[model samples]
Each structure stands twice: as C-alpha cells, then as structure tokens.
Target: MEPARLGSHLVVHLNRLKENFEALKKRYKENNILFMVKADGYGHGIIEIVKYAFNDLGVREFGVATLGEAITLRRHLSSLPFEIYVFSDLQFFQPELSELYLEYRLIPVISHNDDLDVVLNNPKFSNLPLCLKFNTGMNRLGLSLEKSEEIIKSLKAVNRCKIFHLMSHLANASMPMSTNKRNIGQKEKFKELKEQFISAGIELERTSLANSGALEQESCKEETHIRPGLMLFGATSMAPQHVDKSWWQGKIISELKTKVLNVFDVSKGDPLGYGSTPCPQAGTVAIIALGYGDGISTRFMGATLYHKGVAGKVCARVCMDMTYVLFPKGTDIKRGENFWIWDGDSKMFMELARETKTLPYELVIQLTTRVPRIYQID
Candidate 1:
C-alpha cells in the first residue's frame, strides 16, 4: 500500500493469513489441519500460500485436486515435510502417473475399486500411504460404505505407509449438521467404518470430513483432522464465533484496490458510457480501471467502492477495462486516489456478494491474473 500503488491490484497480506490460520489452530488444537491448496490455493497463488503454510505455520499436510498440483508442489517444496492428497483426478488412476505419485511421495485418495486396484496391483504403489473416501451420503466420488471391509482388507496386506485416513465429504456442511439428516448420517456412517476398521485389528491413523463451514458446527468434533480451504484465506461460509471473528475485525488478507482513473461531472440529463444510459442524478463521476474482463461482472454494477472515508456507488455498466462510479454531489476526488474494493473479509465480502447475487468464493476466484498480486509479509 505504500507509495499509493496505481492500477487495480490485489494486496496479499501474509500476516493476516497467519492470523487466520492461527485462529483455526487455537480452537481446533486437538485436530490436525490439512490446508486445502487446490485451485491454486483458492486463487491466492499456490506456491506462495504453501511455502508460508509449511515454513511459518508448520502445516504438515495439504490437499490438492489433481496429480499435477501434487507433483508440482512436491517439486517446488522438495525439502518441506508434507503430505499431498489427490482428492479426485483422472490422472491419479493412470498407469503413467503411478510412478510420479511414488517419486513425489503423493498420497492418492482411493475413491473406488479402480483407484484402489491401481495401487494394489502395482508393487511400487501397493505400499504407498493412501486415503479411502466413502460416499456416505454425498453421492460424489467415493466408494460405498459397505466396501469398507473389502477395501481395508485389501490395503492391510500390502501398505507400509503409516497414513490410513478414512475420508468423506458432507453434502450439507454449509447448513447446521445437528439439524441436517444427511450430514448426520454421513458422520455416523464414517464412524461405523472406522469401528469396522478397528474390529479388523487395524487402527486408522486419522479420519477427515470437515471443510471450512463444517469447522464452525458440531460435526468437527469427531474428526482427527480438518480440511480448511476458504477460511484460511480470510472468508468463511458460516458466521464465526467472537474470538475468531475478532481477527477479521478491521482488515483482510487479500485487499482489492484500484486507483481512480478519471473524475468528471455528470448532470442529471447527461448520457453515460455505452447504451447512453442517462445519468440518474447530478453527482461526481469517477472511473476506475477494473471491469468485467478482470472478473468483476456486470452484477456488481450497484456495489459500492470506498474512497477517502466515503462510499461511491458503481452506477454505470462495467466495461471490459473500466467502470464508472457515482459519488455524492460536490465530493472531493482525484484521478490517482485509491479506492477500496473487496477486502476478502466475510462481512464486507458477503455484503457485496448479496448485492451481486454471487458467492464470496465465486468473486475471489473470478479475479484474473490481469489484476497483479503484490505480496505483503509483515
């Protein structure tokens, strides 16, 4: 933020990221946390977020979506002690990718028989550490719970890696689990599978099912580990407790800011850009450099951008490379003044999302690489 950074840019605050992470750790002290680094660390730059999480936060495990992401992280972070799990990927089951999985020390989640078969048939991967994902109630990529006995029996014979995590996805984690039958059933079934494993004389090393939203609810209790994606980056799907909410009080990790490109006067009768939309009121008109092409769509036309302690409405249609803002009449402004856009704070972010009929997840991920990211580590 020093020297008034010009143009539209995302300021990545590593310090806030640390605070957000520590807050999760403080409350969930008993359960291990696997930082979800998929989708390029939820569009915050994978390498940057991973390195910080590993070195500064002492995070030992990460979860990615593809074989490429797992191998790529292993290459860049050769010295770090970490575990990368491929949740769902066609590449994960390919015979060609089997060696890369062993070489990179990546753990593959066996969602079905083929995923487990690929590992069981190959001597190289037969002994590799793996996670078993069960369908429970998600109906996504997971084996049926009844296959728990057969799957564990197959793995118990050849696996030497100490990792044995029974994993599943909660279809209704965004809602309260105590009130949702599907979520409760998923948790109960997963627990039954764990007991089934113990009955077979193999104590599973861990069990995981919690995501960002699940951590705030009662479902987080039984799990030995939690997978946090969005919350670690400064936004949560659920309302957080006061202790955790305090960290997101005044600031955010990813600060979206843009400089005012132009300032003009628009009378009530004057026509505006594109479509010649007549001005709604006589106000101070300011143009910014961010637009639809930058991932901010037309849905944000009415959202507000804060500048110099005042909020200006995005009055005109968002163009490919520019947007028009309308401030109150006689508002003081300049072409180079910085305007605060989205800050990745759940409160403000969700507010904008409500106005735009978008999700906070959608907005953050939509920001293209065109909006350069400036790292702040202090």
Candidate 2:
C-alpha cells in the first residue's frame, strides 16, 4: 500500500546506512558488530533498518533498550536466526516473561545482582542464554567489579543457564584524546573481571565494551563485539576533536524537507510571529509548514533554511505548526517551493545541532512521529 504524502517528511537513505555499516566493518573486521537499534533505530524506523542490515549486510546481532522493542523486532523477523540483546535491567522479570524470552530465544543482559538471582532461580529460564554487564565506569547499569567473585560463583552454580557474554560501557570514549583515562580505567576493570571469571573455569564466550565512540580507540578495538547505534545511523558520537569526521565518511541518512506555505512582504518595524518581534527592514518572509511541534527546536530560530541554493534566516519565534523565514528584498522565491530544513548535508546538520545546543543524536531522535518517514534505498 502506498503511504500518504505529508507537507513535512523525513527521507531515509538506506544506502547511506549500509555505507556507514561497511565503514565500521572495515575498521573492526575481527569483532562481532551488534548494531544498536533502540529508539526506533534512533528514529529512522527500526524495521526497515533491521531488514537492510540483516538481509543485505549479514548483521546477526542487535541490541535494544527494552523487552518491548526486542519483541517487536522478533515478531517482524521470526524466520531469521539472529540474536537480540535486551540492555535494560530485569526489574519486571517474571515467570511468564522468562518463558517468552526462552521461547523467542532473546538474551537478557543481567545488570543488578537481584535481577541475576531472579533469572538464575527461575525454573523457566534455567537453560536460557544470558549476558552479564559490569559497572566499569558508566555507573548507570551493570554489576560492580567488587561483586565479580560473587557473580562468578553464582554463575558456576547454575546448572542450566549459560553465560553468553560479558559486557561493560565506556563513559568517556568520546573525549579529545584517544587514550582517555576513564576509558582506559574502565577497560582495565572489565579485563580484570573477565580474567577472574576465566580463571575460575567459567567460559565467557564473548565480551563487548566499545560503543560508537570507543570503536575509534585502540584500547577498545580488540573486544569480541562492538555495539554501535549513532554511527550506524550516520551520526557522530562525540565532538569533532574527539572523533575524526573524515574517517567516518558517514552520509546523513535523513533529509527533512517542507514546502513554503505562503510569502508575505513585511515593512520595517512590523511585528512578527507570536513574540511580535519587529522586522528591522522591509523584506520577504516565507512561511514554512514546520515548527517545534514537528521536532523543529525553538532554538532553531535565526538558523538557515535552504531553497534553490539560497539560504534565509528564521526571522521570528517558531510556532506550533509554522515558522517564518526572512529573505532579502526582491528574492525570487515563491510560495509552494520546497525548502530544506535539514538537507542531508553533514555540515548543515552539524551547524543545526550546534545552534540547538544538543547532539546530532538528540536532534534526529526528537523528530516526532507526526512527520512521516519515507525510505529510499538509493
């Protein structure tokens, strides 16, 4: 079925996503790549991204934040043999949920001790595969290094449950220096815990510690697996100083576009928008069918929007469904012409992120579902 077109839409380039994945693959040739597809593939539409990554690129592992996301993906790709890791702690682990995980063959990342106990003690999940996360530095989730011995002992006692992987997160891998102290420290801690378990005769099949930022560092390059989310979607994980933009070669995957709804000739000192900010001089104002309601940040005021190789500044405060763009006198722009809010230009997107005081990831994910998503392989 053909989807209805909207005034404002996000065009996703699946080819660019594949290019980004290939770039990462070249850099981490020996490691398992667990593409992170949480937050609906960072708001790029998870189902399509998964199909392209799995069927076309041979990505066999995925990481999502919640059980619901995993379940949705599982239902969509029921026939494919792939592993989905749930990153959230098991606060809601129950007999029924355990059975579902077993039936679906989902791997749960046990972060807290209590959650580990529940999973190990649950009879339904006795033979289920599990991943143990350690709190090396992120301190957000995962068991502490001090509890490594206890966790090892617990896992050793488990008769049916099997340990699939050991994982930790690097907190500051995106810092300026490649050899960040915190990143190094976290890697060391994780290594120590891994060794302790191995020496105790517990076979940890795989270990993952690198995120998108850590993938660039030599310290994190040797992990058995690397879980990348933003980079896979063609967005940078850190500031430019920390990550070389040239190395990424990641094209912007989403293009945000809208049409000029109307054009108005404003006189000097004329009040504009909700704030009634007066225009400094006579100029042409182009009203676009997009605003904060569509995830266009109010901070985007004074930013540039491009049309036919010409750029104009947002003149007034953004409204819920409309925004005003100011152009020079005698400009040839007409009503109903397409204007690019974000044109899949890397430099422009970076500037937008800077103007909004947020990361590229935040900007893309903030795109509300009100705007339709159109997928294009080319």
Candidate 3:
C-alpha cells in the first residue's frame, strides 16, 4: 500500500468495491445494473472506479449527474463502448453540445417538458433515444404524472422517438415497501406510466427507480434496470441491529485514517479543547491530525476513534484542524500512529453517520479534495 500523499486521506478499497458490486448483482439477479458514478463516484475517484467497472467488473452502463462528468469520462476512455447516462443535464439539450452527445454516446435522462420539447422539435435529436424521467414521488427531478401524460400524448406524432428508457426516483425507500406509503404510491405511479407506454405502443428498452436504498424493496425488482449509487461506494447505511432479509449491507470500501499529531496527559478536571467539558478521568489525550477541514465535523463528538482496535472516546468537540480523543492512560498509542477516523467497517461508518446525524452519502461526498484518495486494490 503506497503512503497517502497527505497526512490524513481515504484508502479506497477497489477490491471491496468489486465485492459490493457482486453482492448487488446477486440481489438484483441478472437485471441491468446502472452504477451511479456521479458526484465523483460518490467522492471516490470517478475515473478509477469507471475503468475498474468496465475493464474488470464487466459493467457496461453508468449514470452520472452532469454532462461534465460524462464528457470527462468520454475523453479518457474514448474507444470504450460502455454507456454513460446523464441523469439531470440541461447542457445536453444545447445544439452546440449536441454533437458531443453522439460522439460520446451520452444518453440524457430528460425530466422537464421543455427539455423534451427541445429534442422533439429538432431533427438532429430524433435519432437519439427518449430516456424519459418522471417524478413519481421524489418531487425532485422528473415531470409530474399529469405533465408526463401530456408529453406522452405529444410523443405519438414523433415516430422516431425511441422510448428507450423510463426512469424515476424514490424519496424514502429506507422503510419497508409494505408499510411505506410513499414507496407504495411511487411504485404504483411508475407502473401506471409503464402501462401507459405499453398501451401507447411505445417500447421501452429499460426502466429504473431503485437507488441504493430502494434495492431492498421488492417493488423495485419489477423494473428492468437498477440505479445504485451509495452502495457501490460501499455505504449500506443500515444499522447493524436492523439488518434483515432484504438488507443490502455491502462491504465498506473506503477508510478514513488520520495520524496522531500530539499526545499528552489530561487531569480529571482539566478542560479539553474548544469546550468546557472536563476530562472524564485522568488519561492520555491524543490530538488527531484531521478535522472538519477534512470533512469531519464537531457533530462527530460521539464518534470513538480507534487505534490498533482499541477505542478512545472523543474528549471534546471536533475542531476544524484537529480532534481530541481520550485513551486510557497506558494505551500503547503514540504520536504519528494512525487512528481509524473510520476504517472499512460498515458498522463503524454507520455509527459515525448516526453521531453526525447525516446520511452516509453526505459523509463520503463531503470529503474535501485536500484529503487525497489512495486506492487499495487488493
């Protein structure tokens, strides 16, 4: 393992990423899987992940959030035949950039009526597929069901409009499909649109609504394609005790490690940094070299830093440049010894997410570029 170019950095376990992908494949069972490579592969170097998926994992399709991500991907692997779907890019509708779409084989997932109009009104875009997106219940991207009906009515005249794919998103799939009202409603709405497509004689090449969390819901299995994002980067976000039959707790592939910058004894009544909270007991307090500047926040006060598998309680509120951890007096930790701000343990990561009151997605993408990512292949 090469040393990280920085004092604190992420060790991205590419092999574990492969494991997670395999797990998702087994769960999905032969369905077309579209890896969500957007947000810089969820802040895990995008190009490396894409190449590994294409050349090593045999994945042929990916979904990104912008033309810039797709364009940058195309520039690197120009000759590869893998597909890149831009989920929310208005740039693809621009006539000036339209050529790049064909050149790069970029498929734009259109959600708005006007964007769809841009494609329908132009002859150049006629040859491209209609990768339509509808806002079933996410209320995010995609058109409303009523608006979608209006557009599907208009598409009847455009014979060249290949209804290649239909896509939507779920707002709260973390709950059970049987009890989650929003999930049930969204699935029904999406199915209604699919039925409409069939009735209108519009053939869809694929359909997707399942993101990382939704993969657990059986309702999503009916769709032809699955778009998993956070899980691919090794974040299941499921609590250990709550994991059930449908749990897709993939292997964590990223580990955030930071070195101990300083170590000193603190009296039982002595105050720790940035807070009036006294040290619980006389112990050795270590100052970790990483903090909020590296994406860790004061909210992680509840996180326990682990060095050599020994847990140390957070002694004070996290600072921008450092965090204080109180270890037992005789603990074998020392300055320069790396502590797992978070290692590749999914449970530890979940605990930190719980402490920070953030989604696992936020934790990964929040990492600043200043914290270098070091790939761990084996």
Candidate 4:
C-alpha cells in the first residue's frame, strides 16, 4: 500500500555518499573505514545507506549506536558477511541479549569494567570479537584510564570476549590549532593504555582513535581503523581552520525540497504564523508544507529559502506542519512551485545552521520519519 504522501521529502543522493566515502578512503589510505550508520545513517535512512555501502562499495564493517540497530541491519543483510559493532553499552546480564548477540554475531564494545564482567561471565560470548572503548577525554562512554590496567588484568584472567579492537574517542579533533594540546594529550593517553594492555600479554588486533575529524588531522592518523560518520554522509563537523575547504571533495548527500502550499499577500503590520509575528511591511508570504514537525526547527524562524531563482526570508514562528516565508512585493510564486529549503548545498545548510545557532547534526538527525526519504542513486 502507498503511504500517505507528504509534500515534504528528503532526497538522498547515493552517488554523493559514495563519492564522500571514496574521498575519505583515498585521504586515509592506511586505515580501514568503519562506516557509521547510527542515527538512521545520520537521518539519511540507515538500511538504504548500509546496502549501498556494503553491496556497492564493499564496506565490510559498520558501526551503530545500539544493539537493536545492529540486529535490524543483520536481518536486512543476512546474506552478507559483514561485522557490526555496537558502540553503546551491552546489557550483558540479559540472557536474551546474550542469545541475540551470539545468534547474530554482533560485536559489543565493552566500555566499563561492569560491562566487561558481564561479558566475561557469559560463556556464550566466548570466542566472539569484542571492542574495548577507553575514555581518553570524551567522558561520554568507555573505561577510564586509571582503571585500564585493572580491566586488562581482569580480561586476561577470564580469557573471554576476544579483544578485536582497542578504541577511544577524541574530544577535539575538529579544531586542530585550538585543541592541539588536548588532542595530543588524548592520543598519548590512549596510546599509553593500549601499550599497557599489550604489555600485559593481551593481544589487541586493531585500534581506532580517529573519527571523521581526527581522520583529517595529520597528527591523529595513527590508527588501524577510522570510524567516519558525518563525513561519510557528505557533511562535516570539523572547523574550517583544521581543513582546506577548497580541497574537500565531499558533496551534500541529502536535498530537502517542499512545495509551496499557499501564497498570500499580506498588508503592512500584519502578523504570520504561531506567534503572529508581525510582517515588517506589506509583502507576499509563501507558506510551505514544512515546519518543526518535519524536523525544521523553530530556530529557523528567520531563515531564508529560495524558490525558482528568488530568495525569501522565513517570517514569524514556524508552525507544526507549515512555515511562512516573506518575499518582495509582486513576487510570482505559485502554490505548486518547488521551495528549496535545503538542496544538497553544503554552504546553504551551513548558513542556515549558523543563522539558527544550531549544529548541522541537530538539523539533519532531527528530521522525523514524517518526511519520506527519496534516494537518487545515479
């Protein structure tokens, strides 16, 4: 059955995604790419992105935030021999989860000593590949450096959960100059912990310290694997100072387009949208079928969008399912005309993000399932 059609939709360009992956692969020639598909491929649709990456691009490893996501991917790609690493903590005590982990062959990243204990106690996880995350500086997840030796000793004693990878997250790989010291310190700390594990006679197969930002830093390239999330999807969270923008080959993979639902002429001092924010002067307002409900944030109240070749300023508060944009007087806008909110243009989205005082990740990932994803593979 056809789903209820919404005028608003996100167009994901598969070719662009492939290009971004190739660019990163070429740039980080030494490291294996663990393409991050968490957050629904950063809101690009996970299953689709994973299929393209695995079937077309030959990406053998994937990184997800949850075990559920890994299970879903495993089911979808049952025929493919790919490894999925769940970055989130695994509920090791749950027998059901242990069964699922064994049945699907999902790798869990042991973050803390408690999690390690769970894995060690469960003989079902024996001989299964595992990843150990150290909290070098992120402090979000992973074991602390102070407890690294203790954890390693415990793991060596149990001899369960084969250590496939040793990894850490960089707190500031984007701003190379500003966070240079912190980045170096975190790397050193991770290295120290990794060496400690090695010296304890625990053989670690691979190490991944570089994320998308760290992958670009010359100093942060010493790793066996790199997990690139935003950059693989044709966007970057890195600051400009750290990268030569001109040399960036990644293209925006998602294009958000909607049609003008209504066109109305307003008088001077008239108000629009939820708050009735007064229109500065008499002008034409084009109401598009897109709003906060569709992941367009309220912060985009005064954002600008282009239709045809003319630009229009978003006026007033954005409604749940509609947004009002004001254009100049006598503007020729039709109800069915395409309103380009974000059209696979990185600069435009960056400008919008700046105007809204939000990050690109927030804007993209918050796009609810209400907006259908249309793929442009060619």
Per-residue lDDT, model 1, residue 370, is 85
Ranking of models by TM-score: 4, 2, 3, 1
**Looking at candidate 4, what is the lDDT of residue 94?**
74
C-alpha lDDT (0 to 100) for residue 109 of candidate 3 = 88
Model 3 lDDT at residue 158:
71
The lDDT values for all models are 0.78, 0.81, 0.81, 0.81
Candidate 2 structure quality by residue, lDDT tens digits, 42-152: 998888888888899999999889888888999998988989988993435465675667777888888888878888876776767778898988989889888887777
Off by over 4 Å in 4: 1-6, 160-162, 177-179, 240-247
Task: Write down the lDDT that model 2 would get.
Answer: 0.81
What TM-scores do the predictions have? 0.90, 0.93, 0.92, 0.93
At residue 116, give the lDDT of candidate 2.
Answer: 81
Off by over 4 Å in 1: 1-5, 156-163, 239-251
Compute the lDDT of residue 242 as modeled in candidate 4: 47
Backbone clashes, candidate 4 = 0
> Please, what are the lDDT tens digits per residue for candidate 1 over residues 270-340?
88888877778899999988888888899988887767757888888889988898999878889887777
Clashes per prediction?
Answer: 0, 0, 0, 0
